[model samples]
Target: MSIGNVSAVLVHGAWADGSSWSKVVERLKAHGINAVAAPLPLTSLHDDVAALNRTLERIEGPVVLAGHAYAGAVIGSTRADSVKALVYVAALAPAEGETVGDVFYRGEAHPLAPKLSPDQHGLIWLPEEAFAAAFAQNATAQELTVLGAVQRPISVSCIGEPVERPLWTDRPSWFLSAEQDRMISPDTQHFMAQRMNARVHSHQVDHTPIVTAPDVVTDVIVEAVQAVSTR
Candidate 1:
């Protein structure tokens, strides 16, 4: 099962866009790896999967599709055959017929997630205060400010929608668990990793590992690329 050369498509989580992977992307490029961040719509499962699939359709070679947080569900549902491996970066990594909301509710609540209230349009967005404390605890004041300013609203519907496919079961998988994550518990991440039989890596960082430890995150992704390419 040795794939020759493959591109890596990085997907951002809730409240984030492709820029979240800027530092990691630079590191990957420095290693002569072909990588790009797929800017997820984060509006709904259907739209997000469509966006990811479109990105996959454009890639010219086998791909290692990496997803964080909500995008994990996106990748699981939209398992493009072009994806040779799936990488979870402090991500949800739900199974088929499961939703991101189901994963969170099944596990104990993280201490920092603000009490959420959905809008009429069914979108769930963290309050501004929760942004700094829960989502970007490891980030500096300036980074937190930038995150708050650019945060995208996610539809609540996306959380409850079941993943139509389970990519991890079909492809080689990797998981990066954030030991200090306050958004999603490390225990829950471990459970998912074990269930998927993923090669696991741990970092004493926050939920946004790409922001706090971009180099290490890039290394983990590069390992997945190598594993897939040399398979």
Candidate 2:
């Protein structure tokens, strides 16, 4: 499978929807790379993984699975045979028995990071103002406003659950390091990427590079697609 011969499935993290990968999807389609964004309910890890699996089931050929933020853990749970590669974009790749929160709160929070608390519905939401301040500082004012408006709330149960064996252990993987990320620390990203022995690509981007730097993000995805296509 050549890069052009494979498809890609993109998974977005908490507080965002498939639209987060809109620009990346457009660029991939332009490259003749069929790509789709999986819609996560953000209700539970099992639910999100099942959602991704449904998307994977629809594709016929080799796939380059990509995840951002929380979806990294979602993708990790996949054992789909069609998946040829893994691309983690500032994603959390928690090992066996480790919950997302375990890795997330491993270190002191970044000073500019927003304080999070679940709402009455047991969902964690990014404050409307958080998009501009910490979530996506590289995004335009208009983008920040829209992000806040269209954000999805993540369930608390999802973060506290442990992940299955990470798919990266069996599949070739690539990692993107966000040097200026305010959500997940740069050090944590590095550690996760290094731990997975992934092909690491570091950038001085914000937490939401798929929105702030789509071209850069697309380039990395293309790299993964091309790599997996050869297999």
Candidate 3:
């Protein structure tokens, strides 16, 4: 399959939506790579994976599945024959016996990281200020405003749920580790990526590189597209 023949389907993490990949989608299209950002309910892992699989169903075969933050488990569990590659962008990939929360709270929390707690509604929201302080520390003031305004809260149940065997275990995979990330520890990212033996790309970006560093994020996805095509 050629670059134009394969598509990249992006899955946004918790507290985010499909629009999070807007810049990367634009860049992929410019390179003649079809792109789609799967809308996740963030209600539960099953719901998110089902939603991603639906988006995967729409795209043709030879697709590269990309995820950020919490969506990593979502993308990994939605493994299907249509997918030829996996891309983890500062994302998590919990083992079969592990829950999202298990790997999420694995390392010591960053001092600048905000404390997370679910509201009465059972949704965990990123405090508005945390957008600039932790989530996207490198984002501009304007970008921070947009990120905070359009934020979506994730269900507490989402992380509590355990994951099945992830596709990264066997598929061609790429991982982009955010070195300056405060959300998910950079150590955790490196550990997961290395455990999967994925081709790794480390950067001095924050948690949400798809927004703050689209070029870095897009380049890796582009590389994944070309890589699977050769295989």
Candidate 4:
């Protein structure tokens, strides 16, 4: 439990690659904090968890493993004990035996998720309109254009796959709720935060808080680092 010097590993969510954390990485580095963004496969939970675990394996010292959106479930199951804490940024943070799909179905459906249907490859992607409105609601015209072009298709199977274990149960956790999130409601985020007994922070931003409010996100992450060090 005593991980000497702590670092951070950032895991991004669906439709996004690791570049989503570019500003966050820069800010953390400016403070001399070691951080790396883990690029998830996003194709399947199994593959994504493997990628996360591999990244965790390479880090030296204690780590605060942070995840956004879908990567929440990924880090939960990756079994990286070097991860002394977790920070969920508008992320799923599901309990053991619960799927991300189950969480969504139980909550009121968002207006912008799009009517999804899987192809022969079993992938599900949000329509361009929904992506623009829900995922990047706070983005400028240029950022929204870039997001549209590079978005990756997520595997439908990943949504319903239950996490075997939830890291939050064993680790100190922080949750940043995007109060203006269009894809996942603010109420649903509150429910998850309460369920996990997390130290919760709120922002008047979209689902992609890392982009819309990097400084606020960085503040919460730095607080988590301080908490772990104190403990």
Q: What TM-score goes with each of the models?
A: 0.95, 0.98, 0.98, 0.94
Off by over 4 Å in 4: 1-4
Query: Of the pair 1 and 2, which is ahead by TM-score?
Result: 2
For candidate 4, which ten residues in a row score worst on lDDT? 1-10
User: Which tens-of-lDDT digit does each residue in 17-129 have in candidate 3?
Assistant: 88889999999999999899999999989888998888888886689999999999998897689898999999999988799999999999999999999999999999998
Ranking by TM-score: 3, 2, 1, 4
What lDDT is reached at residue 178 by model 4? 90
In model 3, state the lDDT of residue 77.
95
lDDT of each: 0.85, 0.91, 0.92, 0.83
Best-fitting candidate, scored by lDDT: 3
Q: After superposition, how far is residue 132 of candidate 4 from its true place, in Å?
A: 2.4
Residues 1-231, candidate 2: write the lDDT tens digits.
Answer: 466779989999999999999999999999999999999999999899999999899998899999999998999999999998899998899998899898888767889899999999999999877888888999998888879989999999889999878888999999999999999998999999988999999999999999999998999999988877765
Task: Indicate whether candidate 1 or candidate 3 has the larger lDDT.
Answer: 3
- Sorted by lDDT, highest first, which candidate order results? 3, 2, 1, 4
Model 1 segments more than 4 A misplaced? 1-4
- Candidate 4, residues 1-231, lDDT tens digits: the string is 232367989998888888889889988877667889998877778899998989888988788888888888887887877888889899897788889887666677677756777778988777778756788788888777777787788898789788887888989899999998877778888999898899999889899988878998888888888778777
Q: Is candidate 3 or candidate 4 better by lDDT?
A: 3
